[model samples]
Target: MTTRAWVLHPDIQTNRDRKDPQPALEEAMALAHALPGLEVVGGEVVRLPKAHPGQLFGSGKLEELRQRLTDQEIGLVLIDGPVSPVQQRNLEKAWKTKLLDRTGLILEIFSDRARTREGVLQVEMAALSYQRTRLVRAWTHLERQRGGLGFVGGPGETQIEADRRAIDEQLTRLRRQLAKVVKTRELHRAARAKVPFPIIALVGYTNAGKSTLFNRLTGADVMAKDMLFATLDPTMRAVDLPSGRRVILSDTVGFISSLPTQLVAAFRATLEEVLAADLILHVRDISHDETEAQDADVRRILSDLGVDENTRVIEVWNKVDLLAEEEQLALIRQAERREDVVVVSALTGLGVEALLAEAEHTLDEVRMRKELILSFSSGKQRAWLYDQGVVEAEQQTDDGFVVTVNWTQGQARQFHEL
Candidate 1:
């Protein structure tokens, strides 16, 4: 059954926000839509000077909105901000509807979208942590009298405490399981290290055309959708660059503004791919009104993940096809002025070659040219160099073959280790 949902973005006047309220409301509605079986009947920005402790809205305003929700038959109300457990319970009781906050809604979407075992476990842990704080709301039945022997003076093992304990136990178990999964991932990363291919990770705001760009670059049909968080599990594919260098391209979960803290902690293992990336492509929907704010959000998340200061990041202004021709020309001109920015339409393959060239050039800028001498007896090393496609030129000398190669520090280290 499709549950009717009403989205409300509380515009806290005292709080300073870089984004406009209307866009925030729209994003909340889109998040509500991302979950299946939820039909958003109405959405609006609710102005508030301050939040009420018991209920988020003022008494009269709450009653007014409650009547409107009843009239509209909204079964669910999604608040696009934090709601204390007490406030949530009070609001739900007063409004006669289920209530979900921004964190809860995002967690629901993640629970529905997580495909991998690691992703599932992470979501489960995050949800449990969130649920743990809401045990007060879950103990509504505790108010009812319980028939029991009067052995203990006080109520024995309150429902809320029991529920919290259960959730804690489950969280512990999930952590153990997550540790195993993370260990396996570490092993996989170690194996990939032997291949010596630079990993390029794509990161940006949700629905920023990262998967589309991934598909365009690697010819991999990852799910590309207009909806937020269309991609959750980290996907990797080897892509041959314009320079004939093979690099691993990783498409990771899209970031969002005000991302749930639980999610950041839970998905740390998944985001380690970004930390290990040789280059990060911060994709942006150039046509979106909140693109600048979204860019800040992505950077904040990256910084939280402890991304290296020296890591190379290229700003990919994507979705240029949606822009006007004049706007597109202006953006292209702007990108031409900066070496780190590339404007491309991933859907139409427009300027994608340039993106690839830029990626290659950025990776190549760190390369160190070295002269290596290989005797005839060292045929294996020579074959390895040729296979790597790093051998720029080779000349046979009386003693051996002098090979000039251009390779990254990592590749050079790998060769010496071999």
Candidate 2:
């Protein structure tokens, strides 16, 4: 049966990291909707000067919320912020409903959406870690009234301890499995390295049209949806640019503001593709009200992942079709002033050709230094290298010339063929 859930964004005034409650609540509701079998009956932003240690809400406010939840028959309460285990248990008891904090809710959505073996293992490990912290002593039902036999932790091993141990074992097992999966992934990455194609990674906040743009550019049937986190697994496809250069395009998991710490640690292996990319396209939902905030969040995550400061990044202003014509024109004009920005609508295919051309041009500008030995009989090829303006230095030898050249990949390929 579908669970009826109510979303709550606790607007703690004294909290240092408080966001605009309205948008936060909206995002929370969207997150709830993204998960399966949860019908969000209603949602609201509850104002508070501070949080209650025991119940998270003030006494009277707690009763009022409880009454309303009872009236609406809400079986679950989704809090839009972190809730301690004590507060969660107390609130659930008082409100007569199940509760999930922001981290827990995101974990649930990830658990439902994970498709690949590595993704599943990562989610499972994160969920186990989260569950470990929630095993409070208040639940007497989990505590053994009598002593245990000597086989377990001798004598008085409480069920809570046993449960914790079990979770720990599962986590250890998952880590082993994840290590194997990661090694296999590393092997595949190594294989791709030999293909001589520049890897371009598309990264951005969730639902920022990275997958749509990937599909548009590569004609790959990757899942593209309006919902948040529609793409979780890293997908790669070789796209042939108009310049006849093949480059690998990688669509990775989208980032979000205040991403769960467990997920960050778990998915770092998956995001290695971004680290390996020759160029990064930072996609943004230009129409979102919090677009700037979202951009900051993505950049912050990238920095946390150790992306180099000198990494070449092109800002892609996506979803231009959602804007007014005047707004679109203004954005286009603004983008034209910046060399690193591209305004395109992945949905309508507008400016997609320009994006491809820009990508090719950017790749072509990346120069690689090479040393070539040309036979005396191959003077035509030697002249061709000089014609390309790539011959940096040359030394005469008995049978050939040893030439040092700094050239783009395209130039290098052309030289090798000659």
- The count of residue-pair clashes in candidate 1 stands at 0
lDDT score, candidate 2 = 0.90
lDDT agreement of model 1 with the native? 0.91
TM-score of every model versus the real structure: 0.87, 0.87
lDDT value, residue 413 of candidate 1: 52
Report residue 133 deviation for candidate 2 (angstroms). 0.8
lDDT tens digits, residue span 1-418, model 1: 9999999999988777635899999999999999999999999898989888889899988988989999999999999998999999999999989999999999999999999999999999999999988877454455643444668665555666767788999999999999999999988986787676998999999999999999999999999999999999999999999878899999999999999899999999999999878889999999999999899899999998998767889999999999999999999999999879999999999999999999999898877799999998988788778877789999999988999999765566557766
* Top candidate (TM-score): 2
Model 2: colliding residue pairs: none
Worst 10 residues of 2 by lDDT: 138-147
Any runs in candidate 2 off by more than 4 Å, and if so which? 139-155, 368-418
Model 1 root-mean-square deviation: 5.7
